[model samples]
Target: MINLTGKVAVVTGASRGIGKTIAKKLHQAGADVVLVARNRELLEKNAADLGAAMVVSMDVSSADEVQAGFKEIIREKGNIDILVNNAGITRDNLLLRLKEEDIQQVLDVNLKSMFFTSKSVLKPMMKQRHGRIINITSVIGLMGNSGQSNYAASKAGIIGFTKSLAREIGSRNITVNAIAPGFIETEMTAELPETVQKEMAESIALGRFGSTEDVANAVLFLASDLAGYITGEVMNVTGGMYM
Candidate 1:
């Protein structure tokens, strides 16, 4: 089994959904986990449930907030070994009907947040010459979707950022990669109408929506030493939905 004992890993947007499961899986693998999100109460609850995890409350979309939050993390955890940039949001609207603020919000939270969080950990990772950066993108990013232009743009940007940053830091022994999940079961998806869900599932070769565990397992693999040689690639967990 893949083991991450002694590794200090941080997962953003970990209060719920895919991010929460990712954090849980990493913690189960023996890594020291840090749960980050804007919801301090929820984060604290999750941290407590983990029995041993640090919680950092901050707006990852802001450069200043990310800098300060990372400083706190470094102070408490000493050094980071894994960074999962899983924080994101969606503002769905047709391009013509999309508000400027919605576009900006999606870009800031879904795309720019990775820039801030990834940059915050570079110094430490580069200094040690070892680290793993895993970004959670989406199938929508790979294949454009109507009414989700902002989300698609943000996710697509993550792919570009992952590739560029991997090349820039490869010599330093840091591997950066992205995971693009297709239709997955989550709180948001649970709220969708049955007809909508069925329609979405029919498109996937798997004939069903994926579980959060499916994505978490992928994240764990990328974070483990088993994938040490892999970098700058996008792992699709779409169950043949976008192939």
Candidate 2:
């Protein structure tokens, strides 16, 4: 069994859906969880529900906010043992039809936020000689998707970032990795038409959409000591959807 007692875990974009579930799992594993999101109200509710130690309402894509937010977290929590970069936004459109603003927003939120958050936690993790950085990427990153060029590019960038950072900090005992999930049954996916959902599920080898618990369980494993030796890899929670 994996245990994370006494660890300080920071989960960004943790107000709802996959992010919230990840935070809940980490909290259940005995980590002193800190939830981050732009939605303060929702964040506060989750913090209360999970008894999280901290909640930072900030736009993670903004470098200044992220730096200040992490500084506050480190100051209050003492140190960060785990950082989950699960905060992402989708602006889906064909290349020709995509707006300039939409492209920029997706890149900033989905891709750039990881750079900010990851950089913020490195010092404390390095000093302690241990850390786990998990980036939530997607299968569209590996298998390109129609009408989602911007989103795909952002997720793919995260994969590269994960590998490079893992290699950079492995000597310091800080492990960086990415999880790519496909067709998970979240609030967003549930809104899709029944035909669309069926079609998507049929493509997966598992023949069903995964639950939030499925992705959260992966985060739990990666964050635990059980995965101490694992780093710089992309673990797919896609049920063989892209293979």
Candidate 3:
């Protein structure tokens, strides 16, 4: 069995969906997790259910909140062994009709938040000289999509950021990687119309949508000791959607 005993991980967007499952799987792997999100009630519920080692309600877009929250974690736990930047938003619109605010919001949460959170945690991780940072992106970021211009751009940005950071911190034993999920079965996918979902399924070589667990397992692999030598690679957990 893969042993993750004694690891300390912080998963942003832990209030629900893939974040919730990632939190659970990491806990089961023996890591003490810190759950962060904007929803206090949902965070609390997840914290209780997952036995999260700690909980921090912070807006990923706000630098001050991310700084303070990471401070609290460092003050209390001394360091974070794994950091997952999973909080993101999508404001789908045609390029011509897209609003400036929509573009900024998507970039802030999907891209800029990783910059801030990764910065805040790096000091402590460098001190310990060991860390794992995973950014959740999308296959659309690689292949592009019609209406998700903002999302695609932000996710693609994460891939570039991950690669760059990996080079900067590889000497310190820090591994940075991005996971681009294909069409996964989540509340987000469930929200799509049946016709859209069917069309998407047809495109996947796997002939179906991936589950939250599919993505979570890939994340666990990257965060665990098994991936210590791996860094800066983008793993596609997309049920063969892009391959």
For all the candidates, what are their Cα RMSDs to the real structure? 0.9, 1.0, 0.8
Off-target runs (Cα >4 Å) in candidate 3 are none
lDDT of 1 by residue, 53-87 (tens): 89999999999999999999999988999999998
* Candidate 2: regions farther than 4 A off: 191-193
Off by over 4 Å in 1: none
- The per-residue C-alpha lDDT of model 3 at residue 209 equals 93
Candidate lDDT (C-alpha), each: 0.94, 0.93, 0.93
Write down the TM-score of every candidate.
Answer: 0.98, 0.97, 0.98
In model 2, how many backbone clashes occur?
A: 0
Clashes of each: 0, 0, 0
Measured by lDDT, the strongest candidate is 1
lDDT string for model 3 (1-243, tens) is 666788899999999999999999999999989999999899999888975459999999999999999999889887899999999888988999999999999999999999999999999899999999999999999999999999999999999999999999999999999999999988877877899899999999989999889999999999998999999999999888898
User: Which residue pairs in candidate 2 have backbone atoms (N, alpha carbon, C) closer than 3 angstroms, thus clashing?
Assistant: none
Q: In angstroms, give how far residue 6 of model 2 lies from its true place.
A: 0.7
- Clashing residue pairs in candidate 3, if any? none
